[model samples]
Target: MQWSIITIGKPGHPWVKDALDLYWKRLRHYARFDHVVIKEGPLDKVEQQIQAVCGKDPCIVLDERGRSLRSVEMANWIEREEVSGRKRVCLVIGGADGHSPGFRDKAQVCWSLSHLTLQHDIALIVLAEQIYRAYTIMRGEPYHRE
Candidate 1:
């Protein structure tokens, strides 16, 4: 299965870029994964940029108040999606001010990394790393420890 990550704006810090690239490469080794970066702007503009990628594929939009899942749970969810004949999965990360109102309502799944507010750059890294961890867990790899 292929995973498409839609993130608003580019990495703010140099290290963030390096970290996401590392995880991006690692994820590709396990499954087809790629990132789509939309131009960042005010809430309205970013939301407009986001709408272009919303397609028939299932989308999991990240927010601070969405459902929380453990790494194992995420792995199981991915497995279930694949078994259900999902060809591609979309994960969306909003801009600096977060997603515009009602934007997340369109998602098939709404996820939150944590209750604490995360900067968009850090959120990108965390999302990428967690995805890598999820894939490792699915493959029974040692990269993820219980």
Candidate 2:
């Protein structure tokens, strides 16, 4: 299955961009990956932009109030999606004010990286790394150590 990470706004921080590049490169070996950025804007506009890209794929929103999963659990979840015949999975990371009520309600999965709120750029970076780690774990690689 293909994976798409759709985020609002671009990563302005050098560190965030660097980390994204690193992990994205690592994740490339495992599955098809797509990174999409919607121009920063109001919640409704951003949600529309995200939805346009999502098409029929299951959308997973990243929000502080969402369910928290361990790294291994995330891997299993992705694996299950593939087994269940999902062709693509879109992970949406909203802007500064978080997701709109409509977006949250329609998302197939709402995943939280942590209880603490994170800057958008940092959240993107962390998401990239976790995705890479998850793939490594699934492949029985030594990259992830319990």
Candidate 3:
């Protein structure tokens, strides 16, 4: 299945792009990967932009209030999605104010990286690495050591 990370606003820190590039390259070896940025704006407009881009793919919206999963559990969840015939899946990182009520309600999964709110650029980087980690776990690679 194709994996996409849809985020609101671009990475502000210069090195954040390079940091994500490393994970993106590693992740591409395991699954198709795509990154889409929704221009930052009013909550409703951003929600619309994210929704239009997400289309029919099951979305995992990142929020502080969401469910937390271990790295291995995330891998299993992704595996199930593929076996269940999902063609694409997106992990969405919303803007500073977070997603609208409608967007939050419709998301198939609401994921939390941490209890503390993270800087947007840092959140993107962490999300990318987690995706890569999940893939490695799926393959039983040495990259993920218990």
Candidate 4:
């Protein structure tokens, strides 16, 4: 199974890029993991950017209004989805103002990282780490446990 993260804006900070790269490297060992950085623009334009990257794949948009899940649960969810033969899973992170209601409605699923607002750069790091953690847990590694 392949997994890709599509972000609305470029990651500007060196530290954020480094952290995101670390997780991407780690996740590559288990599955195809990559990130697509979309150009920052108007909300409609950003949505168009995301749409182009996502294509027709199953997309999970990260939003504050999305469902919250435990790490183990998320791991299981990914495993099930992959086992069911899904070609790809696209995770999207919106811009500073967040996603439009139309985008939210169009997403297959909306995932929430936390209640507090997170910078786009920081959110990318957190999302990468979670994907790594989810894979590790699915593989029965000690990275996550009940």
Top candidate on lDDT is 2
Reference-based TM-score of each model: 0.92, 0.95, 0.96, 0.95
lDDT of 1 by residue, 52-112 (tens): 6756778889998899999899989988988898898988888767875587887788899
lDDT of 3 by residue, 1-146 (tens): 99888888888887998998898888888889888988888998888888888888788899988998899998999899889988998889988888777788899989899998988789999988888898889988888899
lDDT on C-alpha atoms for all candidate structures: 0.84, 0.88, 0.87, 0.87
**Which parts of model 3 are misplaced by more than 4 Å?**
none
Report how far residue 36 has shifted in candidate 2, in Å.
Answer: 0.6
Tell me the deviation in Å of residue 133 in model 2. Answer: 1.0
Worst 10 residues of 1 by lDDT: 46-55
Candidate 2 C-alpha lDDT tens digits along 39-133: 98788878888889998889999988999999999999988887898899999888887998778999988999998888888888889888888
Inter-residue clash pairs, candidate 1: none
User: In candidate 3, which residue pairs clash?
Assistant: none
- Could you give candidate 4's per-residue lDDT for residues 20-66 as a string of tens digits? 77888898888897788888888998898888888999889998789
